[model samples]
Target: MEVYSERQRISNAVEVLKERQLTVGLVPTMGALHEGHLALVRRALDDNDIVVVSVFVNPTQFDNQDDLEKYPRTLKHDVALLEEVDRERILVYAPSVEDIYEGNTISQKFDFDGLEYEMEGKFRSGHFDGVGTIVKRFFEIIKPHKAYFGEKDFQQLQIIKKLVEKNNIPVAIIGCEIYRETNGLAMSSRNVRLKPEYKEVAPFIYKTLLAAKDKFGIESASEVVKWVESQFSKQDLLRLEYFIIADTNTLKPVEEKTNKKSYRAFIAVYADDIRLIDNIALN
Candidate 1:
């Protein structure tokens, strides 16, 4: 597959593909390709005529400097994996900070209908604003027919949906399923950062989720949250950040049940400084 390192070149190439009457699909990523990323590419391939995978580790999105510094950047290996997916149909856009931001280095603000007020938003200040800025830039540059994102970042997915809705962007925002390992840890680029022994303990996060799912059907949100906290407390390696069962759409904690609404459980933990987040459908 061909790779473009310039934003204008990416825009021009996508425009050329448009001229060919091709439906472009965009899968924005932060490199260090895994099965989860390839899954998005495959889904994009099925639904669109051409898929453009972006591999830029957006600096703006990370609130922690060390987190951004530690974030993996394996372009050579990432492209090698993409080559296995489908070289002819995929165009890898591995741009630099200068390429994406274009030296427009200034603070920006964005609102996702109060989405950034809770959960990750409550924790990571200005995180989604950075996400919104970069994603907004990607949309403006790529102009894809459809953009694919995994539901693992369900909150970010909701935020992007809000952005698209508020801006009236002409494109479909497709959220794919969360891919997992056989032992049940959610597939993440950060998974590679886990220490060898810690990786063995990481699957407990999912095991806890599975158990929480079962308990959620019979227990209250408060009760489940307490149980989740207790589970994390027992393991010195895992520190629970926040566990809540909330309205899927509104993302507010749901104390009272509604028959028609959807509910989900979102959990974040620090597996010895390597934070991992995962969620599951409760109903």
Candidate 2:
């Protein structure tokens, strides 16, 4: 696998690949490779002749400065793991902040309609705008045939799909299934930041979501949310942020299930100061 730290250099390299008539697949990620990240790359390898993974913990995406500073930077370890995926046909684009936002460095505003109104968007201000900015930039830089993302960040995935639709971007967007630990914790790079004892407690977010899913079939969305809140209350370390059953497409909170549509239970919990988010299909 080859690595490039500059946008122009990688653009030149990908241009050469395009001249050879090779189809390109992209899996954009922040450094610190985990099973979840590799899942995206693995699928990209299967679908395209060449795959490119961009590993930049974009500074613009973090709403909290402290959180941004705390974000992991494990590029060396990440590249080593990608080498295990494929020694050839894989190009790793690990660019610097200046490499991406050269010159004036102004961030573009993205209008995601009502999609940014609740949940993560409500909590983390300007987060999706940052996401839209970096993703739009990557689309221009990589110019891949397809790009892959994970369902764990369902809201972000939807926003990206909408971004492409809104801008008429040519690449296809694929949302891979959420990769989880055997114990059911949704895989996240932030999982590395969890306090050791809290790590064992983290999987309860998924377990509670699983229970909430089953309850959704028999109870009202509000009732199911109360049950989930109660479950989290039992854990001293887990602080429930918000629990809501919402329409997958609109992302508006749902009071009850409708047969004609699909819904998901989205939850956020803070365990020993480490925040974790997970969701499950309710329909």
Candidate 3:
């Protein structure tokens, strides 16, 4: 794999690829290699002639300094996995923060308005703005025919889709399925931070959402909330942040008997400081 750290070199390489009439696929990531991330890379490889995976731990996205500091950085392992995927066709761009941002430090803020104030947004204020800024920059730089993102971050996928549509970005944004473990816990890079005991209980987050889906038939939103809350309350180790069953698209809170075309149960909890988020679809 050809590794480029500077923008000029990467741009030149992309130009060379374009000269050969190759369709480029970009998989933007923050550098901790996991099966979920690999799923995105594999999808990109299948759809495009050339695949470029950029690994830059974006500093702006994290609201907590400690979280950012502790965020996993396994560049060595990450590249090894990518190389195994397709060494000849894959290009790894691991740029420094300064190289990616330069003096263009101003964040691209969104009035995502109501959409920005719930679930993940509520907890991580200005997070999507940071996500928007970096993603926009990456889109401009790569100018790929398509970009792949994981559905593990459903809200993030929605935000990126909105950004592309509203701004008229040309690249085709694709979202892959949420990769999960054998136990049903949605695969996440942050899963590494969970304590040994917490890891065992982590799958319950998924279980609770599954239960909520079946409970929906017999219970109201209020009742679901009560039951889920009690379930979490029983586990002293699990600190529930929000247990919401809302309109999957707009993410607005749903009331009793309000049926929608699509619905989702989103939950966020802190298992001893390792915050995990998961959602399940209720059709």
Q: In model 2, how large is the Cα lDDT of residue 51?
A: 95
User: Over 4 Å off in model 1, which ranges?
Assistant: none
Candidate 2 local lDDT, 247-278, one digit each (tens): 99999999657899999889888987778988
RMSD of each: 0.9, 1.0, 1.5
Point out the higher-scoring one by lDDT: 1 or 2. 1
Give Cα-based local distance difference scores for all models.
Answer: 0.91, 0.91, 0.87
Cα deviation at 239, candidate 2, in Å, is 0.7
List clashing residue pairs in candidate 3. Answer: none
Per-model clash counts, in order, read 0, 0, 0
Query: What digit string (tens of lDDT, one per residue) describes model 1 on residues 10-115?
Result: 9999999999999999999999999999999999999999999999988888889999999999999999999998989999888889888878854468878887
Q: Is candidate 1 or candidate 3 better by TM-score?
A: 1
Candidate 3: 10-residue stretch with minimal lDDT: 105-114
Q: Model 2: what TM-score?
A: 0.98
What stretches of model 3 exceed 4 Å from their correct place? 103-106, 256-260
TM-score-best of 2 and 3: 2
